[model samples]
Target: MITLSRRHLIGMGAGALAASAVVGALPASAGVKGYVQSTIARMSLPEKVGQLMVQEVYGVDPTVDDSRNLSKYGTAKGVDVVRDLHLGGVIYFAWTNTYDNGPDGVAAASNALQEASLETRPKGRPDRPVGTKVAVPLLIATDQEQGIVTRFGPPATQFPGSMALGAGRSTKDARTAAAITGKELRAVGINVDFAPDADVNVNPDNPVIGVRSFSSRPDLVADMVAAQVVGYQIDGKVCASAKHFPGHGDTATDSHYGLPEITHTPEEWKALDAPPFEAAIRAGVDMIMTAHLLVPALDPSGDPASVSRPILTGVLRDQLGFDGVIVTDALDMAGVRQKYGDAEVAVRAMEAGVDLLLMSPAPLAARDAVLEAVRTGRLTEAQLDEKVARVLTMKYRRGIVERPLCEPALVDRIVGIPQHLEAADEVTDRTVTLVSNDGTLPVDVTDRRVLVCGWGATTTTAVADALARLGATTTRQTSNAPTAAQITAAVTAARSSDLVVVLTNNVATSASQVNLVKALTGSGTPVVTVAVRNPYDVAYYEANAELCTYSYSPVIAGAVARVITGRVNPQGRLPVDVPKPGGGVYLSFGDGLSY
Candidate 1:
């Protein structure tokens, strides 16, 4: 068994915070007292403080140093504070190679992390009450929001984002995918998942949560939110959080940049954005993460939702009746750090009924301030007890109390098992949407030379691979727009050939890419705009026919190919509002085709 020194623990805690200020710095080993004991017991001031600060883990460290990734274990020298400060948990930013448990190695890494922590506990703490033995286990968490926001497998299967699933208009699919996501998460030792973004995609041009959100319609969002909650919480896989409450979808700005304000009236709030949360509460979701955006209608005093009582306690708890943990968005993000000091914000969050104060820039200072507030009666000890109790309740319910040691030998079997990867492939396959089509799809180029063009035209490499598998002669070109020379070349090649297939995977960020699509439209021949991005761009082209397949993922690519070949009928519908060119939006919130 590894021995943890008092000195080692202190150093880890301090190092973890210091590392966050500057990149390439190492994080202190997380949590001091063993997970079992740390779970209970009146913690020392430093230990209590440590539990509140969680830094992002990049990868494993070899020697605790400037170049280390604090999140990965068995790599670098351990940061001392993790053992000394008695921190609560660590959020993995990226996974180490060691993190392969079954279901794409989600559980294996979790097993290894917990096993390592258990070995380092002081000799006195036993796994169980062999005549009053004490133990404390660490809580491990991940952002397994499914779809595009994953950090698990190189070949890990990905589901369409929540919005895409919503577009499919089936709660059954949402629930099943969530359950699959949970299985993968649990197999990796991740007990907490920050997921099921309940935000309705109200703003189509919203830069960030476009497809990540469910639907613009609150009712559909509510059902999908309920499905996600059920899927994760079932079969004891993991705890679920329906997040960015009040809602992140209505705002046009990204909270990652700065505090965003949602300017809805109270009536608009209850009618549109609040239904999903209400549905989540009814479903008994485990946690709720607050958004950093400022909503004047929710809290006219102008405080962000994370520190606002009206939103956190009054609306979320009292109105919606949610009594679980309320974790704030990362405090280190610009939304909070740019405005207030960590300690001040931490204390206010507690006052506002936030049970978990996460990702603080100054963990020590923030932890100390919250403790002091309680000690000085600014925040009562009773309040501290309540907050800690909620955390403990989650831990106990999740079976973190006994500090079970995952068998190290089982790690190999659990990490990246083949079945889960297949699941990812299938989920991705099923989610490809065929938004719109003109008559000219399913191109047959048996003997004809096919000319493919546009940005990410290479993404069609998968489609090309399939065509190669089927023994088709194809020529692919990489150009934003075909020049007059390029067009003449294409027409010359096509003058005697069968058909023209214009594969367009344009990036929406640049206006130039949109112009390129228009340029490619009238190139003296029949053309099809095969859109593999935001399908809204398809309107720019005057192709004889057009097809929309919203992603370039292998499974989605395969699905798109099948749809084009007439093997599969078009099934997916547009879930969020897709912008129409010339100042009109094509799709709106709540637009879906049930199958």
Candidate 2:
């Protein structure tokens, strides 16, 4: 590592600093705490405030302006995000076109952003000393939660969702999956991952956290959360985050659209919602993301956990003893913005013990608000320093300060290799739960005609291709909400086929899919229904055979195909209960059948 002294950082120009081999280098003997304290001591108010915000920019190149960039939030020009705002971190999103050309493109963009971040800015104000130019490297982060919440598309190994891993109940597989994901992320220059959603999905009707959560059982969720935290932080290459703290699993409302309330008492909260977070802390997770949820037992005030001191500081920081960084969920969400504007929301979260403000809709306004708060004694300078210190401490502990730049050429060699792909396929194969099977399975499809119908075009195409590759003569019907004509065509196609495989995504809520399944089952053909999104969909329809994959990725489709073809045995158990048409449990947790 190239070691730079304080004098060198101040004396060098922006070009010289960018060309240097190493940026923000710390001495080997200097402890992380000491380095962070020293760095914060010399920072200006603007510089210190900037270290607390992790903003988003829209582009694949740091210098170019992307059409999708929201200039009102920050700068559309990517380089300005680093130079003008001096952000502590930048988040990448597929919607912002940051992952446009895949791994190499992301790596190149990360390198450019880091170059801008490490460059020395001019000391203009009187309070800014000559030797303090703010040469800290950015903490690049992304939401690479694999299954349904993935930002990186193909060529990055697509692992199964969290509930699928929970169904398999293999901590070793969970650890291996996280290790592989962490390695690939580091290869592409991302230093932090917002993942391992530790929420316990006790409420089956929870709109957002269904398959994203590991399990309904708190003990099992704790075990999986600890394993993933250890896996992601292996070698400290990437920082793992346990999220939606205080739990978003039992709520019916989506926090993105509106605020959600959880009525669990303190006893119930500790028993049901706090285990995974406790386990994450024990496993030394680098960060914990606060949820935008209101729990009256934890804090009687109506403020959401993202802006509640009793919840964030009292419960998470003090009661749970989490000394690591505490980050908020995206500040632009309606859950936290109900009572305050962008400026007030940022200030309130900071006051409540959040160390990092993520994805503020108006990042500049938020920064200015915090600055004003500090000036007016609404928030102390010591409080701001404490938060910035936590961020820097994470950077040093995770080796982000030592290795800020990535080589684009190395990304192709490291990502989506044969080993990583095989691991993902194996994990997915182990997660295919055979809920019910009749004598119709393990069909001899060598020359048999089969009909495949599904709710999504991608799902139908993947399943059809997988079956065709296995020597079955395959025909596919794809529709989100099947029309009468579409259902009639599927029924006609099923009559000529030896067997029919229907994929359902939340069929319990979609009457059209239910009707489609009934039509196919009413025909004389043997039917196998696969609930690709949620296992609870099987209760809404009847079939000769039933299976649940808990996800809809290509890997899951291939695994389902192999399981039905008798190439792989079904080993997955249910992670959550399937409710009956009445009010009871249709299939309890841990219910599954092997071929």
Candidate 3:
């Protein structure tokens, strides 16, 4: 029996008080629900409003001596933005620590920063009870769209883009890709994955959605989006966010530079942009990130989707019945920030029913503004409570509210597992589409001299290597450099032997390889042309035969090689119409293989 004097008991009491403040002003195992209740009881009307802000991690400069982010001398000002302003969380951008191409580095950084933030309570306040820490763990989110849009490389498995998956046209294939993506994300400690872009890439001129969107057809895109939600959430337990709500598919402009407008009316909206988002919401997605584009038919104010109440609350919440967390695209992007200042954008987003104000340039300013709105009665405390409750609910569901210490060693074991790579290779095979081929393929290369040209030749060397493996002595040319003279020589050599496969991968600025395709078709050689990007290239440059590899991935490259060498039959049909030269529609979205 340990008995203590009154003075000693008082000292022990003081230590407990200190311990409570350190944890979150609650008991260690109190759980998020109990913690939220305790926290809500103590918050002032103004304090509750501050939790809605989700600001940019890079807003404050760490080098400035008196900088709000930190004082000069390596003190972390980044952590202060969340702690001092009592911000809800942060959205990582190019400035936060660079990821180690995989999830391990990201996970370590995310866990460390979030844990550090748990300390640092104003001294007098009862040490934050264990579970009731005012600074809820930071929500680690990123744009990991796999292929070209991947934020982390190397350690992270890079697969073909969403469009390539759409080209595959199998829900099972899409889900498998999503599962691998989810596992990789969890291993890295990123809880929030902003992905499965629901945007339909209907416009060929769509510079942004080129490889990001899953498909052009609404139904196909919707199905794929649903599959991604399952992969990231069900398979990995990461909170998956389906993004660019209401879609940005048909727009010609990129939102990063300016606000892109969608001219279609509300009815047309239902027909095109709404399906994938609707499916995603119905699939029980955890978070829905708003887009920056303007839909005049949906709201005539020229307001981007992030600020449109009709789009966010009226449609997504009221009509569509989505009760999940609503997050904004990065608020610092020119599409939104260039027009609306950070504070105003923050307020408007909250009013418009956005639950998370993502990556705002002025996080503290936004927090102050929301607090002021509550003080002035412009935004009620009840509204803030509702939003906080939703956020807290999500945290609870993710088991993050429990504050589990996941071992780093466990993370190392699961990343880049063999099964994931095997699945990715299989999915890649199903997506290879053959648009038009005359009998020139399946070259018995035992005696054939082959010439391969185009950006595909330069970018994906797998095509050339595949040909070599098939016993064909192949010559490769990139752009127009291995010009008429070089191409003519290769043609002369191959003319006496067998096949000439001219592979063209088009780029926005220059598909100069088109000229090479023309030369190959004109040379009176046995030519089989392959277009690895847009299918229309097949028509633009006539050849004896043609194949469309809708994407350029190592796996897709391997599948293309097998098809051309007659090892496998090309089973893909155009999901979108491959138009005539000078076609009315410049690009096709659903134009991929079905089987």
**TM-score winner among the candidates?**
2
Question: Candidate 2: where is the Cα deviation over 4 Å?
Answer: 1-24, 67-70, 125-132
Structural similarity to truth (TM-score) of each candidate: 0.81, 0.95, 0.82
Q: Which tens-of-lDDT digit does each residue in 1-595 have in candidate 1?
A: 2222346434554332122222111111222223324334634444444455554433343123322443232223333334433546666655433333223233434433443333333334554112221223456777767655665544444565676677677887788778876765665467777888888877756666766777788898999999999998874367888888989887778888888888889999889889988898888888899999898988988789999999999999998889988999888777766567878999998899898877776766777798789778889865665676677666655655433323334434544457755655555545555544455555554544555555565465666555545445666666665566665555565444344555664445555545544554544556656666555556555566665555544445556555555555556666666666656776554342212
Q: Distance from true position, residue 349, model 2, in Å?
A: 0.5
Regions more than 4 Å wrong, model 3:
1-35, 39-87, 90-97, 101-103, 120-135, 403-406, 444-452, 456-458, 465-476, 480-511, 523-530, 584-595
Best by lDDT: 2
**lDDT of every predicted structure (CA atoms):** 0.62, 0.86, 0.68
RMSD of candidates 1 onward, in order: 8.1, 3.9, 7.1
Per-residue accuracy of model 3 over 1-595 as CA lDDT, tens digit each: 1122346424643343233244443435676677777666765554455466665444223221234344311234555444555556655544554362235555545544454444434545543322233545556677777755766554556577687777777888788887887777767656677888998777766777765787778898899999889888888777888889878888888888888888888898899988998899888899998989888887888788899999898899998899999999888778887668888888888988999888777665777788788778878878888888777677667755554223466665767667666777677767667655566665576546766666645444677778788777877655534566765665565565456777665533444566666666766777777766665566567776677766665556667677777676666545555555565653344443221
Better of 1 and 3 by TM-score: 3
What range of 10 consecutive residues in model 2 has the weakest lDDT sum?
1-10
By TM-score, highest first, what's the ranking? 2, 3, 1
Estimate, for each residue in 1-595, the C-alpha lDDT of model 2 and write its tens digit: 1223446545554463553334444535567877787788878888888889998888767678755554554456786667677789999998777887778788878877887777765556453334446678888899877777888778988888899999999998888888888989999889999989999999988998999998999999999999999999974279999999999999999999999999998999999999999999999999999999899999888999999999999999999999999999999999999988999999999999999999999887898999999999999999999899889888888887877776566787789999989989999999899998877787777788999996888988898889889999999998889999999999999999998999999876799999999999988999999998888898898899999988887688789889889999899999999999688999999999997
**On lDDT, who's better, 1 or 3?**
3
Candidate 1, superposed: residue stretches over 4 Å from native: 1-39, 61-81, 95-109, 116-134, 402-430, 444-453, 479-508, 524-526, 530-533, 550-552, 587-595
